[model samples]
Target: MYESGEVAIPLKDRVFGRYLADDVKTTEGKVIMKNGEYISHEEIETIEKENITSVRIKSPITCGCVNGICAKAYGRDLAKGEPVNTGEAVGIIAAQSIGEPGTQLTMRTFHVGGVASSSAEKSNFESPSDGKIKIQNLRSVVNQAGSEIIINRTTELEIYDLNKKLVSTFRAPYGSTLLVKDKAEVKLNDLLLEWDPYTVPIVAEEIWHFRF
Candidate 1:
């Protein structure tokens, strides 16, 4: 269940610093008959003066300094007028005068990746041993026109140990499109495996070429 509170009146936009009591006064001056009993603001004022009962202020009053007192009175008046759903009514009024209404609020959730429980620095080491290997006959063609074209050929290789643990990963440099001859035996700690060759696949090779 929600709670209730005094309404906050905005004073920044008020044209005049003060609000007149006459502006907030009812059309009929405080006296009337209701259910065979005399009902009037005068009677209530009299009771208030005599200290017989508490005086309840009504809202929409244009009394002096409407910023603080008048605003609270307006909220109270609304609450009393609609006691069954005063919470929503008061909220609407408060949002209109004191805060922004109907604005979307957003929140983001993030998830961490990798093996470490906390953030860790990346390692520069590649393999446990050192060896020498070489690739040969590499060629690359670049097609740069308004339409799509193909240029380079490449292959993917993944080397792993007998235990199936990934030892190293390598990609051929751009422009040169043959087996990397000098890149072999570069201290690869595991077995050698190669993937099928990739043919020229799209245009813009000069702009989107792979480096390693």
Candidate 2:
């Protein structure tokens, strides 16, 4: 029997039959108490958990049309004597505010830690003694591990695979020594040695989730 007055009800004072004057919009809009909705203890607990200030109770719908001023629009029917429903549900807005950014966070690229790189030497005519390993495609294995400086002077280039067995494997020098350290971040070409054969590992695969 809520009429048409705006009043605030304390959380503790809320009992059965009291309509939540405000729409409990968080995950979704929860209308705890409508014009004739029965309030339950669970609803009260929800209000407390959500930390809503107070509840809006119904008041007497006093008609002020005597002065030729219709309190409401001509065709608009008042519910329980109150104006057209003013309760608003903004749960969607709340959802998008958080959800949209969260989606971007997932799709967007981020630097992941604990990422080490592996590689196989590109096949070419260059020899290690000359400080140049002939890699068929320098861009492929070169970027995997940072640029290399060959001190081994061995014609056989040692390439290692840091990743596990999946399907494709570029056999440069299998079971070779690893050049890149665990969890490294590098920008622009850095000279580790004067005559490094490989290129800097600029693009790394740290997050395994994104690899597949």
Candidate 3:
């Protein structure tokens, strides 16, 4: 219905008696109209019932020096956002690419206060088997609570059964306090070590109010 030379038009604005430029098919591959078929009121009603918004109509037949095939190829290129002419500058293409909606993602990040990114804090290490505990490479200091807090990173705790066979090995991070002494007997799931998490809890020891 538009006065311009545009081939595709909205289905509501499509001119009756014009020919279909391409085949129109349903989503299930049923042909609604074949290429070059004349569009009449019946065809328009059928297409509208199919919920088609736009349709391509055959362009006016032209004479003279114009190559219809070449014109169609250029039209397809223009529709696809491809450069219509050779030697198009790369900067122009880059600008066009950046202007697309897909390239406009926000760089903003969101974070919740007081939520730690680390995994769940482990406060205690339990013995994995019934065995005697043997400590190695341990350097620790006894706290006021009479707990031996390991200060070294290389400490390895080994568990050996009654036959002196190694049952399991355990390592605790620095600042971990031993719950069982060296050569202490422990059963499976028994407490072997304990430590506070790396992150401290936020506490307000004193309350003060300020008017803003």
Candidate 4:
């Protein structure tokens, strides 16, 4: 078993000025004095209270100020050590510490694409208009997306600029047809749908572009 100190002394002996050379331990190797504390009257009292009879002193108990507590001097003399992780909640702290520079991002509008409004009559498809018309409606599928996407008769579309800033949202109005169902793969040239030129199609582009 590990003993308290290297040299044993009787409890009655009063070594007035001394330094604990090594960590004092119980007979079973439990630590007592942590090896560097200045042996002061207070420490002695504590040792006496714990009934520790003797303590080992280093080869030299080399401190001039034995009259008072040497803790301040010992602390100054102590070397700096690497930081220890206390298993703190670092993720929470990091999240909180992050600063948000501006106000809330994103527009208030939301859109659901590929759904035509219910108010549009299917009979509108019977008559043909002179404008260029494209016919397919499919959605671009993402790898992680599910196999099914259900689009009702109404679909909403939110448009954003290249900067990812929200520009506007479009909900399929009356007289529009929904050509694509859920989870369909579509490309840029794929037809979104036939647009009523007299109404919302190029007229929309004209209004946006200020083309009369």
Instruction: Specify the highest-TM-score model's number.
Output: 3
Model 2 bad stretches (over 4 Å): 1-9, 14-16, 27-35, 61-212
Report lDDT (CA) for all predictions. 0.34, 0.35, 0.64, 0.40
Q: Weakest 10 consecutive residues, lDDT, candidate 4?
A: 122-131
Lowest lDDT sum, 10 consecutive residues, model 3, at: 1-10
Task: Evaluate model 3: give its lDDT.
Answer: 0.64
TM-scores of the models, in the order given: 0.19, 0.20, 0.39, 0.22
lDDT of 3 by residue, 1-212 (tens): 21111122455554355556789888788988988676666887998899775677654352122533223222213335432343334346647877644444554444444644454556777887887999999888776677777776677789898778998766666777778888998898998887666543232223456698
lDDT of 1 at 26: 32
By lDDT, the better pick of 1 and 4 is 4
Model 4 lDDT per residue over 1-212, tens place: 11111122445344334557678676667786787655656666767777675676633245455453243223222123222133434345445555332112244344434544443432222212112222223222212223222123234443334444544333433334444443343333343333342443211211133356
Ranking by lDDT: 3, 4, 2, 1
Judge candidate 1 at residue 65 and give its lDDT: 56
Candidate 2 C-alpha lDDT tens digits along 94-131: 47678866876898954444523344333232211212
lDDT of 2 at 37: 38
Model 2 lDDT on a 0 to 1 scale = 0.35
- Candidate closer to the true structure by lDDT (higher is better), 3 or 4: 3
Stretches of candidate 4 exceeding 4 Å from the true structure = 1-13, 59-212
State model 4's lDDT: 0.40
How many steric clashes between backbone atoms does each model show?
15, 10, 0, 7
